[model samples]
Target chain A: MAKTLTIAPVSRLEGHAKVTINLDDAGNVADTFVNIVELRGFEKFCQGRPVEEMPRIVTSICGVCPWSHHLASAKAADGVFGVTPTPTGRKLRELCNSVAYTEEHILHFFFLAGADFVLGPGADYKTRNVIGVAAAVPEIGKKVVHNRHLGARILNIVSGKSIHPVTAVPGGFSKPLTDHERDMALKMASEILEFAKFSIAWAKESVFPKYLDAVKTVGVIKTGYMGTVRPDGTMDLYDGKIRLMKPDGSFVDFDDTKYADYISEKVLPWSYLKFPYAKSWNEGFDMDLDHPKGVYRTNTLARLNVCDKLSTPMAQKEFEAFRQAFGRPCHLTLLYHWARLVELLYNAEYAVQLLKDPEITGRETRVAVKPRAGRGVGHVEAPRGTLIHDYETDDKGLVTNANLIVGTTHNNAPINMAVKQAAKLLIKGGKYDEALLNTVEMAIRAYDPCFSCATHNLDGRLAVRIDIHRPDGAVETMAN
Target chain B: MTERSPIGLAVTSVHRDPAEERPEPEDFLDKEVLVIGCGNVMIGDDGLGPAFIKHLEARGGAPAHVGLLDAGTGVRTVLFGMVLAEKRPKRIVIVDAVDMGRAPGEVFEIDLAEVPPLKADDFSMHQLPTSNLLRELRDQCGVEVRVVAVQVAWLPDELRGGLSDSVAASLERARELVERLY
Candidate 1:
């Protein structure tokens, strides 16, 4: 008789999720599902609100990636009003995006997933967390805290608020970067750049080599990729054309305004999140490990794979090394961690470069705009993945319709596929331990997914519980 | 500057340079008391936290030694900083609306040790591990942590703004209770 094993509320990686694996009579894995709660009513809530309010209103969607939403919504509002931001305004927005990416990437790499690498996956559960990482590597721990704090400080200076920022507006930045503020932010960005450099180096020298075996096998999948890049095919997180690469390394770039033509969302009955696939490929949606159709991934690995080169010098060098070793379109899911470090270096370098530009401190950051009936689509490379915000407004400047495809939503199909792959690979004949189960979670962590943003709701309760369903229908539940 | 205590506890030294530790422009530790409201304004009664902060500001805010912050859904980041900071406020008071099977609009105080496990998988800080972070601050860092909770009248399943009538009315009472903490 077949039995079902459930890992509810998979620890870490943001938001709630559960893995349900079915075992055949032989105790071999048969099927798997990753169920995530759905967030409803955000679009309905945005209806009737002023288009100008979206940048601020959308920040409340998820505390984790508010900056992403804030900027995306602001860009959408700019589209609705049909006004481009001043050059300085655009630079300031990009600067914030870079800084925010640095902070988020650091947090995800060091604190969230760091526990796994810093303290071996088999380490005791109680000691396998941020605190554990701090305890073990006290010096690195201090640096992590200090740098993350620096990120907040820089944002606070550049914008009035760091968490729920209101600086980016429909026309441009609400606040101008003064010379003094710019100096302060520049100093901090330099510090973050140093840390980013140290981070990638440390990982390359110490962390990655130790996990070489795991990196090559765990959660490995052959899927297409998605990310944002400049006209020259250089990675650009703030603004660029969207590129969708096929599994075979071939790709096409499209305008953000035309995303609907290339991509479409599929509703799955088991999960609240929607699976987004390449509609333009016309391959249809399938998560089969051997041959997936229209299934592509976003976030770090995708961004690295989709971009032809990194805009910054140091990052470009690292990018070349990565591609030389892995080749175009690396399919190893765990490479997301390595790719994240590369992007971190690029963002840090980009932030410093932006600050050095004299125009970044200019006075004219925003332009005047009149409300008009229009539709706008804005896209950004959020740390999690490619984030797209679509909005429609009336002549009165009120939002009539709103649609958001967060970075995590795009990876929904990929995450499920990865989880299934890991389960099938590891749990043969139903043999699994806590460490093995956590390895399954490592697959999800590679995506650095934010279910909170994907679902757009918060209930403030998360606990990990696993239920084992026997052939007789009896259930045994376990929690951490 | 550092020492190991428990697995999940924060270890920070008390005496440190304010300039070296504070995150600039906002010296939360300079205040004797820190009061933060945590919730999402777009989520019905969940908006109580920000709503209460606005109410407190309308009433001229807290005293000079008290710091009032509307953390929204980003309370975890703030609390995490405090835990790792070399210097921290003597006391922290978190105000939010929760459903604990009590009467709507009921104002109550919860001891830090009693915070239930209600959050998980929040990348930055949503709610569950916030309690854990608070506990670490109190037990590991020696900061007094208190929770002021309001029983939400109704929490919508979907996004909706504004507090319910009862929750709105209780803000003043919650404000009074929080001010007394300072």
Candidate 2:
């Protein structure tokens, strides 16, 4: 007999998710599924619209990561129009991406996941939130809040609005960076760089060390990894070739447009989100912890694992130490936090470097782009993972077809695998408590998957309900 | 090097050639009162916030002291900016839609004390956890927060834009209530 235990509306990480774990006759873990609600035909509705509108329209796809969608769609449109942005245009876009990443990563590390590490996983539910984090670690909390604000301000200066940005257009950015704006941006970038320095040092000294034991034991799995990198194998977030790396640190690089040939989506019966697997592996999709196939992770750890080196000096040093401590292709699930900090430092340094470039303040930011019929693919390493936007346009420049594989979508299978792995280790013989449940969630949190972006259509009514179904298929209890 | 302003301290506003170019970060911070309409214009009935704000703006606009923002599900970021800003609005009036089993188009106020606990904690305009930001503004930052919610005729099943007739009809009244708040 198999009993089912369901945890609905998994909390805190953006959007909604439900975890269903099955228990065998002896109360041992049997299987698990993470059900996500799919967005209501956003890509379908995108068809027939003027392709130029994509960069603007896609911003609404997810309020949380609009900058990623905006820039990715703009680049795809650039591909469709067969035009390259001027040096300033490309640099501005990259700068915005870096700033946005800094904001998102800080938000996640301090406010969202911070509650777990700062306050302890077993802390009272009421006090285990952003406000709680602020109350407990007031100084760090202020730093997080202030730095995030600075990131937002930088974005506002670069783009028009920090949330639904309109600055990135098909050919390039709409506005030119004036001398005054350049000076302001560089100053902010330098300050952010300092904070980035402090953040990585703080995390290493105070946070990662305490979690080493949990990192080794919780939700650890061996899977392939994916990220974007320059031709020289340096980590890149804005634009680069896609690298698909195996568990052993070996990888293959492919053009961004060839993603369809390497990846295929698997539709599971219970979940609305599709499981993206590496079709290139020739090993069909499977989520078995012991013998998973075609499964891979994206986001921070994946980017760190797939890249040969970091571009910035400080981040390169940090990366070296990380590799020294944990061999290449680190299997520790919790190391994502450590990897995220390193990337944060890189973005900070990279942003300052870009701003300091003479060409970054050039008056010509865009090239004239004519509407043409063509297929185009664009990708960016969104703070979460690799985000790909593919589009086909008609001779009249109307969008004939549109497809988006957001960063979170690529990790759908891996997230479920990680969840199951953690549940098996923590929920032994169906013994579980709130604290233990949170520890299990910590595994999912490490990946920082955005269910909202993965499956954009949520009904807005999210309440966490736990349902325990007995072996006889009768629900023994339901708690909300 | 340009002087980098300290956290939670007022910074000098950047001057621009076009006087009416989109407001800068300083403008967002300097508002004495903010009336932000929070909702998704893509879902039926959920577009109440934008609809109400639009009606109000069309009716001879708010005073300079009152910054009327069409947040459009991006309230979280706006509120986050405000939370970290050196200056903040003394009052923030949020117009939104809620389905609490009330009559269609029925408008009501959700008291600060009535906000449910932060489950997801991530705040948004069209989502439940949005109340967390309002609470934070009220309790932590000392910004007076008020939510005016219209009983929605169920949000559309698909991504159909525009408001339901009932929700649309109630926009005027909702606008009036919000105007009174400011």
Candidate 3:
């Protein structure tokens, strides 16, 4: 008789999720599903609200990546009003984006996924966490905390608030940077750049080599990729055309406003989150490991794969090394951590560049706008992945409709496929241990997914419980 | 004004010397008491925490030594920063809505020990690690921590603003409790 095994609320992720694996009568792995609870009320809540309020209101959607939502919403509002931000305004917004990326990348790489690499995946559960990482590598831990704090401080100076920022507006930035403030931000950003340099070097030296075997094998999938890039094919997190790349390295670029034409969302009965696939490929949605159709991934690895080159010199060098080792369109899921470090260095470098720009302190940051009936689509490369916000407004400036496709949602299908691949590869004849299970989780963690952003609905039910269904019609439950 | 203490807790103001240069992150912890309202304002009764903060503001806000913040869903960023900071507030009071099988609109205090250990290794703020981080702040960091909870009547399955009447009514009561923490 077949049996089922479940791992609920996969630990160390941003939000709640579970993995259910089925075994055949021979006790061999048959199938796997990653169930993520998604909130469905945000778009509905945006309806009837003034378009200007979206940037502020949308921040509450996910505390983990509010800056992403905030900036995307502001850009969407700018689209609704059909106004381009002043030069300085645009630079400031980009500065914030880079800073936010540095902060999130550090947190995810060092604290969240770091536990797995810093402490071996097989380490005892009790001693495998941020605290454990801190206890073991005291110096690195201190640097992590200090640098993370510095990112927040820079944001606080650039914008009035750091967490749920209100500084980015439809026309442009709400606050102007004083010379002194710019100096402070520049100094801190320079420091972050140094840390970014140190981070990738340390990982290359200490973390990646030790985990090379896992990196080459775990969660490996052959899917298309998507990300934002400049007209010249350079990675641009703040603004750019969307690039969709095939597994074979072929690609196409399109304006974000035309995203609906290229991407389509599929609803799955078991999971609340929607699976987004490359509709333009016309391959029809599928997640078969041997041949995935229209199933592409976003976030770090995908972004790195899609971008032709990195804008910053140091990051460009790292990108070249990564390509030389893994080749273009790298399918190694674990490389997401490596790709994330590259982006971290790029963003840190980008922040310093923006701050040093004389125009970053220009007085005219925003332009006046009148509420009008219009539709706007805005996209950004959030640390998790590509984030798109679509909004339509009436003449009265009230929101008539709203749609959002967060970065994590773009990887929904891929996440499921990766989880399935990992489960099938690691669990042989139903033999699995905590360490093995965690290694499987590392596959998912590599994406650094933020379920909090992917999920919009909340029912107040919180816990990680696993259920084992035996062939005898009996069930066993386990929780963490 | 008379100093107030809540059950075995002593409240005292620690003002920074005027001559000292105050950095930005430390400015947050400069107050003797920090009251943070944590919840999603767009999610039904979960909006109660921020609503309570608004209520306190409407009532002329807290004293100079107290800092009131509407953290919304971003409380983790603030709390996480605090846990790792060299300097921190003497006491932190978190106000949010909870469902503990109690009467709607009911206001109660949850001991630090009552915060469940939802995920032991989960450190992400988007998960249940907020409680874990809170515990860490209290146990390892030596910060006085307290929780003021309001039993939620209903949490909508869809995104809808405004709290249910019961939760909306409890805001004033919750405000009073938070004031007592200072």
Candidate 4:
């Protein structure tokens, strides 16, 4: 008989994940999977819709990181519409991207991951949360609140709302900015800049080295890194080419527009998350390819590796420092948080520049868009990794086909591999405890995935719900 | 004024990322005051109290208390942050947009402890929900946090300076309370 410990979906953190450790005949730890059991089928439900609705429709993915999906989805739709965003549209889009980064990254580090660091992994699940952080590290907790609070406020001003902004339309914003909003954005950007810088220095001084030392040796090392880069060879979020750094720390043909030829997603039997492989290696590949196989990593660390240089000098320095430590293409997964803070710094600096820019407050927000028929691929560097959205539409502008390479899907392969490694590291049949749970959570946290969206649809209308089906076309379960 | 008592109004969006990444202070060593405020500025008059709180935090007049927190319309997570801190603050004041149905611009303080109970599905950040916080305070640190709220006039999605003329006029008064409270 196998004893299974169940952990339910908790607020804060990325998404709902369940861990069930399986025991062998002798009741030892034979195998375990930190299962993302809840089937969030945004793809299946999104079929046969207008390509224009893709951005707002997919905003139903997750409450915390909706803006990420919105941007990715919008770009995909924009691509289908066959329009290159004007410079103003691009700037506003980046501005919105900055807000999402500030809010999502800060929320994760402070409210979600803060528990493990401040309260220790041994803290009770109910008490070991953001509330616990406030009681335990009140001084720092306040700072965390101030930082995220300001970010949220800034998003509301620029995009009209923080989470599921309706401003970033197909070609551009719904309403152009007023002078007051722009001025307010600049002032708040200053505080947010301070907030981000404080975040980076604090992590370096207190958190990074400690976490790096502890979990650096936990997972099986894999070095293939990937992310998005601007055509001009700078870090980018809104529009850029996807770059994958090979294990040798060498660049593999920096690409823009030609994305479909390079990336492919596969599924492993162990975990529900999809495994993405480079198009070259995906052929003739089955689930388990034996030992010493190439492992592709998405999320912050991979993005850090692919960029020519960070958009901001401070982040570039940190990137250099990170590279200097373990050599280029760092393989350790636990260092994802460190990469995120570095990006946060760059984002803040960029936000300062965007906020202070006079162009952002312009009255011209829309780029005249026409519904000409063409297949377009919109790729943006989601906080997680290279998020690619491809749409094929008919002459009427309705989406005939759609494909999404979500950020979490890229992390699936590494997560499955890391789980086995982490399970083996801990002696099986040892009392089920916080240390073991932390080991599992930390492994997936390395991926830093944004799973799905949850919205109430406001206006007294019910938002979309998640539906998971089986191979036989029957509903496995419904999360309403 | 239709001010809510920082108890029930909540904000939700599926497009946002869940709290995968939390924020640490840019300068943890320099942080001092934490103010927890909530309300949607775009939603008519709901922006009242939280808007005032934002004004003060932006201007940097918060006392040398500890930190100013904008819990937003998501008090559940805000409470989570408050309870997680290892170094408990000397004081905490929760500001929000409430609907007391009073004349607009009439500022008043209400106790979160005295507020009505929220249901299981209720996810509002208006008033600091106490059930979870109370347990953590007593069991973990042996101290219950404090909360403050102001009356709300309207909660339409478009509250610029003209929409809430009362809140816009009484904004300074609300700032004064925060200043005094700190």
Candidate 5:
């Protein structure tokens, strides 16, 4: 007899998702499925709209990481017009990206996944939230709130509005930073840098040490990795060549626009999100733990594994330490949290370095764009993962076709594999509790999965609902 | 003699630089009442809150001391900042659309205590965990909070913009209720 065990609305992820595990007559884990509800027909609606408005229009796709879509769309629109942003324009955009990264990483570490490591996974549900974290760790809570607020403030100053930015235009940024604005940004960046330093140290000293056992055992999988790197293979979040590294530590690099040549989307009947695999691998997609094919990951740990070095000095040091400790191509899923902290530090240092550059305030922020028919593809290392935006324009510059592969969508296959691994490792003999299920969720949150941008909705509902089905096809049990 | 001041309303976007040393913009910190339109205008009836705010601004008869903001979907950012800054308005009113199994286009006020617990903890900052934030603001921070909710007519499953006719029609009624509350 085959039984189906379901975990719907995987809690703490950005949007709704479900994980279904199959069991054989012996009640052992056989297979797993992750179903994410995707926003319907967004690209179809984008057709016929003027390509220039894409930055503004795409913000509504996901309220969580609107900046990612806004910037990526703007970059695509820039490619369409064949105009490069002025140096100042590019710096401002990168600055915002860094600030946004700090804000997001802090939120995830402290409020979302923080509860798991800070208070332990078995803590009562009521005390395992942002409010509870604050109560338990008031000192760190205060610092986290203040620094996160500072990040938001920096974004507000640079982009006019942080949530749905309209500053990035077709050719370049819309506004140039004044000397005063630059000075203010530097002050904020300095404070943010302090917090970023404090964060990584705090994680290493307190959080990561406690989770070492879990890191070694939970959701460990060997797969290829992907991220953006410069010519020298330094990590970049804004613009760079795409690098897809195999599990064996060998890799290939290609131009950003040539992603289609290397990647392909595979659709499953139960999931709304598409599974993107490395087409260049020549192997078909499979999530088999021992003999996986065409499976790779994106996001923090993946970026760390794929890049040769981080551009900033402090972050580079941290990366080296991480490498020496874990070895390259680290398979531990829980180490994603540690990798995220390293990136946070890199973003802060990078922002400060950019702000100090005198050219960041130059007047030539934008280049005039003349529209014509062409195709453009833009990619960015969004905090979640690699986000790509592809657009086509007609003779009049109206969008003819649009396609977006957000960060979470790229990890669809890997998430399913991780969830399956965790379930098999923990739920022996089909006996499990809420804490056991949460350990499975920890596997998903390690990716800091942001489905709000990958899919779409606004109902304030929790992700991760569970339903256990017996071999007889009857629903057996349900839990939060 | 006629009044010297012109009859007009001022509308402002919420994005601001914290470094600017500007005064309290006519008691923004101590206002007796603050009205916020909280919804994503891109969806159908969810635009009611912002629509009602627009209607009120066009009508222009609320008390001079009261401040109105189109917080849109980023209401959490504003509310969270206020919590940290300790500069909350005395009374906060949130206008939004909800489907409570009520008639379409119907406008009503929900007691803060009666508001149900939000479905899950918020995973994104674009939306605050509203029920929790509201309670925190009222109970912990000692501020008065109220909700002005309109029953939504439709929210498309796809990326469609603008409000439906029935929901748009309720704008006037919502404005009237806002005026009475002020």
Candidate 6:
């Protein structure tokens, strides 16, 4: 086929995405792009509400990892309120955060990523997902389900609800946990440790090393990475100073107060979602497509790049080992999901320790919140990556405006460019098999974009779009 | 001493936030009657559950002694509330304002069997809550739970000002049902 093949609005995941494979006249590959098709005006929605209610309002953004946004928005609100929680408050926030990471990351790895590897890339797309894995490896499949259920249950215990929680508010939790709740959660999380360990090896040994040579040449976009920097200078998921590092692994001071300084976002004519790039350009496509310049990456890969250690022993060891092979800073996106598992493992381990600690039962249950009207910013790392809730408001606490940079926002440019790159690679075949398509799907998943979490509202007009360029002219195609 | 915990007389009539914003689980710990008012009280009728919780809270004079939990908007907290009960109750009266095509504030104490598990869950901090959790416990531990809800005039989002006079009057019926349940 002389024309580019496009499948817009990829089905079944979340939100909108269209996959396009560019083809030349001789039917050779040109480029591939998986265009994201949603925009979150959550930032605007958050403006003007009494800053006190910001946490609750923003927590509704994503059902998968509410704690991330809840904490991020709360911290931002804390910034506006000029109030930071006592150390205990920070710990509680971290506890809430750890539970979220364990649940969300586990689900993504096993349910989302498991299909491609266990089911085999060549398997039928329909049968190559969770269902296929369940049929092929019943025990491991059951274990994943069992562990996932336990993780969800733990979230239920800690925050009251598993999916979209409201437990970790601005000042502190509204209720104190009893010893029984703590004991039960600790026991359940401990059981999940074995399952999580099994999953990481499944990635590192079974998946990563096997596919290493293949993916090493793929997803080679080099851009600056961004994530929250801890006080200890390690990667922090719940709360920390924001760190923007160069592609060469050189790090600068981490600062949350000056977020607008290092990072930036751009909207492509092809995708509704905004692409976040480095304010300073290092390499890749001209970020300003019209003029094209900057290229920076954020989220999990960025977190991994910016961190030297994982807080948990097992994950930290794996981190050091992976870092050794991939070099000081890893550029491959295939390693992205694997890094997520590493984070998930540590989160599980940390959750067990925190729940086992007796002091948790006696932790101060609430923070006396004095909402003397001001703006606030909340920052927490979501499962996919770092999330920010920036709000500006008047003293009446009525929000003037709200801007949210979600897990996927940070990868907007790279994700789209990846699709284009892959399309350019696979454009030759007029007829494509499921395996090739799955590879295309995996390319998008590398970024782990949560489209549903980003797009708010029921405007059903959604599609995945790709632009195909021939030597003579360019054409656009779409699907829903 | 009694067959079931008499939760009604021990209730405090405090209206819960319609959004169920509390971080705690449902008053599942209470295990008797949970008066969940699904409205923002500052705006008016959403104050239904908290108003009742305050009444119940006042009854025992303290929250710890009186299991009158203000579930706020947290539906998931329902389990923790039920589990908190040493011995589950026979009937659980939930006083949330429902627009069931009835007179505003006309409180109805429908038996658990009669409420047909409309299964429409509270979107608070809970997921697949109420009936599902109750079933899990009953299947695992054999605890039977019930609910009592009142009909309101305005919609949940439409309850802008306060409870309609009719819904406000329903509080009396809810308060009365609490008296009878205990």
| DockQ of each model vs. true complex | 0.16, 0.15, 0.19, 0.04, 0.15, 0.05
- List candidate 6 segments past 4 Å from native: A38-40, A280-293, A429-431, A456-480, B1-182
Q: Isolated chain A: TM-score per model?
A: 0.95, 0.95, 0.95, 0.87, 0.94, 0.91
Pairs that clash in candidate 1: A14-B121, A15-B121, A461-B118, A461-B119, A462-B118, A462-B119, A462-B120, B119-B128
TM-score for each prediction?
A: 0.92, 0.90, 0.91, 0.69, 0.88, 0.71
**lDDT string, candidate 3, A1-480, tens digits:** 777777766777887788878776667777777877444458868888878778988888778899999999999999998998889889989999999999899988988899899998898786687777888898988888888888988999888788789988888887777777887779989999999999999999999999899888899999999999999999999899999998899999999999999999987656667799999999999999999999999999898899889988999999999989998899999999999999999999999999989998787778776778999998899998999999998887788998999999999899989988988889887688988888888888988887876854434433233455577756665544
- Stretches of candidate 3 above 4 Å error? A38-40, A456-480, B1-26, B116-131
Instruction: Please say which candidate is ahead in DockQ: 3 or 4.
Output: 3
Compare the candidates by TM-score and give the number of the best one.
Answer: 1
Maximum-DockQ candidate: 3
**Clashing residue pairs in candidate 2, if any?**
A39-A457
On a 0 to 100 scale, what is the lDDT of residue B46 in model 2? 75
lDDT of each: 0.83, 0.79, 0.83, 0.61, 0.78, 0.61
Tens digits of per-residue lDDT for model 1 on A273-362? 779999999989988878888899999999999999987999999999999999989999999999999999999999999999999877
Q: Can you tell me the DockQ of model 2?
A: 0.15
Per-residue lDDT for B13-61 in model 6, tens only? 2233323334335433334433343333533555566566666555552
lDDT of 1: 0.83
Worst 10 residues of 1 chain A by lDDT: A457-466
Candidate 2 stretches greater than 4 Å from native:
A1-3, A38-40, A456-480, B1-24, B54-60, B81-86, B113-131
How is the predicted docking of candidate 5 categorized under the CAPRI scheme? incorrect
Task: Judging by DockQ, tell me the better candidate of 4 and 5.
Answer: 5
Error of 1 at B18 (Å): 28
lDDT of 5 by residue, A309-354 (tens): 9999999999999999999899899999999999999999998998
Give the clashing pairs for model 3.
A39-A456, A39-A457, A41-B159
* Chain A agreement with the truth for model 2, given as TM-score: 0.95
